[model samples]
Target: MSNTKDIPFSPPWQISDLGKPDEPKVTELAAGPAVARFAKMPIVIAEDDLVSRTLMNSLMEKWGFKAVVTKDGHEAMAALRAEQGPALTILDWMMPEMDGLQVCRRIRESGKMVYVIMLTSLGAKENIVEGLHAGADDYLIKPFDKNELLARIQVGLRILELHAALSARVKELEKAVGQIDDLKLRIPL
Candidate 1:
């Protein structure tokens, strides 16, 4: 006969002695698009929601890219200004203190060619147009899937690359003109 009070306790880590089923560990989803994997640059994500911010950050990391997350447009601006080297920004359309549209215009006015993608809950055509006019390279609506966001980001990166190429060509042309002016001075003009 066994005493009821004398039962030995089993360690929880003893897998064979377990009674209840173990709960499944949660795993974060990866970015759905392959383009995300090609990004080797740093990107800033400005989103107020904690869940969205974490999801975006994890996706960026999984894609082998560096990411900084901010709660509002103002913080995003500060990060952009302080960061060295190349960086891209993803701004939420509506935020406290400063909005995405305002941030985009401000960044454009600074004359720095940082790629910007605006994320918004406003999916209307007019709203998207407005965002475009505000200097956003691309627009994404809320509840967007990972693949859609990644694709839009690729578009912004391509546009930025083109802009950089054009700007370099213009600079080269300007330098040639300056050299020609020097040659003209040597000709006694």
Candidate 2:
């Protein structure tokens, strides 16, 4: 992990070095367009109520994200572990299998940096504090206007972007430190 060189540009077996010398550079041509045409990343939306889930899904899709709708917190957790998971989750506070608070706790315990927004009917100060304590990045009370919901989500996305940038910077610093160590090792005593 200290070495960025160990991180491959493409995984083994993804491309072959055994190709003909004059193969027209097919791999680069194919990959260039594929990466350019990448689809919108998905967002997972968990709401037990049918109407609420549908509304959330429609809103998320309208915002140019692929939305996965689930009626239970447990199901949403499973989706989170799936390959190519959503970068963010919008959770309703009340749900079967497990409640939103429990789900948020589980997500935090897993130590993955997935953005979470808890949409609940409970608007009291204590309730908001509890949600924040349970690891919700944003808390939205029920009967919230669509504009507010979008605005909060926009804020969450910005926060997530910031987190990603910070992570990258940390990785870069670690790599630089490793290089310095390597250079020191090569120096005479």
Supply every candidate's count of residue pairs whose N, Cα or C atoms clash at under 3 angstroms: 0, 0
lDDT of each: 0.72, 0.70
lDDT per residue (tens digit) for residues 1-189 in model 1: 865332222211232322222321112334333233324456888888888889889877765556888999888989888765445899998888889999999999988778888888999999999999999988888878877776676676666555655666677779999999999999985
Compose the digit string of candidate 2's lDDT tens values, residues 33-78: 2122111334678899999988888776555445778899988898
Instruction: TM-score for candidate 2, please give it.
Output: 0.76
Candidate 1, overall lDDT?
0.72
Candidate 1: stretches off by over 4 Å: 1-38
Can you give the TM-score per candidate against the true fold?
A: 0.74, 0.76
